[model samples]
Target: MLNIQNTKLFWASCLALLVTSLSFGIRAGIMNQLGIDFQLSTSQLGTITAAAFWGFPLAIVVGGFVVDMIGMKRLLVMAFIFHLAGIVLTIFAQGYWSLFLSTLLIGIANGTVEAACNPLVAALYPENKTTRLNHFHLWFPGGIVIGTLLVTLFVQLGLGWKVQVAMMIIPTLIYGYLFSKLDFPVTERVSSGYSSSDMYKAVLSPLFIFMFICMFGTAITELFTGQWIGLLLKNVTDNAILLLTLTTGIMVIGRGFAEPVVHRLAPQGVLLLSAIFAAAGLYMLSTFTGNSIFFAAIIFGIGVCYFWPTMIGFVAENVPKSGALGLNLMGGAGMFAVSIYTMFMGNFYDNLIVKHLPAGASLSVYLKAPENSASAQALANAKNLAGPEILQATLIIPIILIVAFGGLVIYLRSRKKSRSVAL
Candidate 1:
């Protein structure tokens, strides 16, 4: 039976996460508008977006280290303040610096949510750490679906991007209220009587380090692509936002029912399979277009469905001594890598478009040309040509993960065999 107090805390954590992902989805939806309104280039927009990612690691890593000292409640309260400030600042943002600063604040809030809630959930349901964490994380994609659908609805109703962004405030306030009224518990590491020194030692272990490195691959494969999907697929489909919605929608359902898969494959086995599908799906997305892209999206969604939570779960189960610090560090590393990659991706995408443009035609010149004119057509062709190549470029990350996870699975099985033989 579920304990009433823990259940309430769990749902509040979910609501907090919902707020975090809603920001992501809304930002993805508004990227084009921000570019147009601010006279910003894709690279500039990516920098603003990258702020959210890079800032996340800063707060999460710091919160992880200090959460035990300051308490989860305090961290969450900080999240509430940051969320409100970030949202209001973003709604009023003027240009690059303002947008970057606001996004950085929101990213910090997002990280704070994870820093407190991940360990909270793990502590709340110690017996089912992996499965429960998957359930907890389902909200990441779930909130994206909500945010994207809201963006679609608001856009259709002739509402501006500012209005769409303001929608997040409703949930943010509710989560704040929910969190304030709750009584919090100590983290599992503390409850289990482990020392902070033990956590530090465990995080530096070879196994933990290996997983930390793998986090970069898994996170980039999942988040970077998700964030950029609208731009990447815009040339190929008018309903690009729907594709993001569809992809995350699949993730929602898959994660909701993740227990069976986790039980059957084990975490490492599941990761190996996820990496395989992610690589294949990403490559397929690069190659496919039009209605056929939906098929590719399904495969891609399935591949990344278990990645974030499962990676955390693996560390929690396998590296218990590392505690909240380990979980937060894993998440921090992933976001930090994505931060750097987002900038590179934006720059690479711009370069690709420039490479594909006709001789004597610059992107700015073509962009300002009359719609349906020869110059506009040239720009369209460039986007179409350049987009797929970018997706293909990202294919290498998942491919590397396939080998890494496969080795991990084999090594783990060998260790199990050795123990059984000795017994």
Candidate 2:
């Protein structure tokens, strides 16, 4: 029988995760507006956006270390405060720095949600860690779908970006209220009698370290692409935000029905296959244009649907001794990698525009031109030419994941065989 209290806590965690993903979707939708309104370069925009990723790692790592001592409720309270503050600050942001700091705060809240809730769900359903984790994480994409649709609708209605951003406070408050009223269980690591030293030692194990490194590739493959979908694919489609909606919509379905897939393929097998599809999908996106990008988006969505949760679940199940710290560490590393990559991608994208432009032509000059002028058209042509190249460059990350995950599959199988033979 299900414990009602545990189920409620689980759903509350889902709601909290929804707020995190809403921030992502809303931010992706508003990237261009922020750039234009601030008269900022792509690199500056990227830096502001990347602040969230940077702050994510810091909060999750610290929350992980202290969660056991400080308790999940307190951490969630901190998340609530940060979320409310960040959203309000973002709504009233005047310049790049304000936006950066506000986004950083939201990122911290996002990380804290994962820190408390990953272990919360794991502890709630100790018997079904991977499937439940996948179910819980389904809300990430699920919330993105909600957020993106809101942005689409708001855009249609001529609503400002700030209004879309303000909408996040609704779910944020709901989740905050739910968490405050409920009681949290002890983490699985604590209940299972593992010491802090055991967790520390386990996280440093060879296998854990290997997976930790692999998280970087998987995360960038999924997140960097999703977050920048609007900008990267803008020239390809009239409404690029819809592509984010489409991809995340597919993810919601994939993750919602993750159990049978998880059972059939195992996490390692699923990851290996995901890497293959993600690489192929990215390649197709670079090569294809117009409506064909939809097909490619479908492929890309399926490829990344299971990545974040499965990665966390694998650690939780296989490296149980590593506990919350290990889980948060994996998540933190992924976000940190994304932060660095976002900055690089912004500069690389700017350079690519220069490469495609006429000799000695300045992009800034084009930017300052009238909307209907020849310079504006030149800028458009340059962006169209440069956009696909960004996707092509990202293709390498998933290609690397294919090999890494393939090796992991073989290694795990061999170990399973060795243990069975010995037994």
| Candidate topping TM-score | 2
Give the least accurate 10-residue stretch of model 1, judged by summed lDDT. 359-368
Regions more than 4 Å wrong, model 1: 368-373
Q: List the residue pairs that clash in candidate 2.
A: none
Residue 252 displacement (Å), model 1: 0.4
Error of 1 at 352 (Å): 0.4
Cα displacement (angstroms), candidate 1, residue 169, comes to 0.4
Locate the minimum summed-lDDT window of 10 residues in model 2: 363-372
Per-residue lDDT of candidate 1, residues 1-423 (tens digit): 349999999999999999999999999999988987887877898899999998799999999999989889999999999999999999999889999999999999999999999999999999889999999999999999999999999999999999998999999999999989989989989999999999999999999999999999999999999999998888898998888899899999999998999999999999999999999889888999779999999999999999999999999999999999999999999999999999999999988988999776677777567778988788888988888899999999999999999999999999999999999
Please count the clashing residue pairs in each candidate, in the order shown.
Answer: 0, 0
TM-score of each: 0.98, 0.99
Stretches of candidate 2 off by over 4 Å are none
Residue 95 deviation, candidate 2, in Å?
1.0
lDDT of 1: 0.93
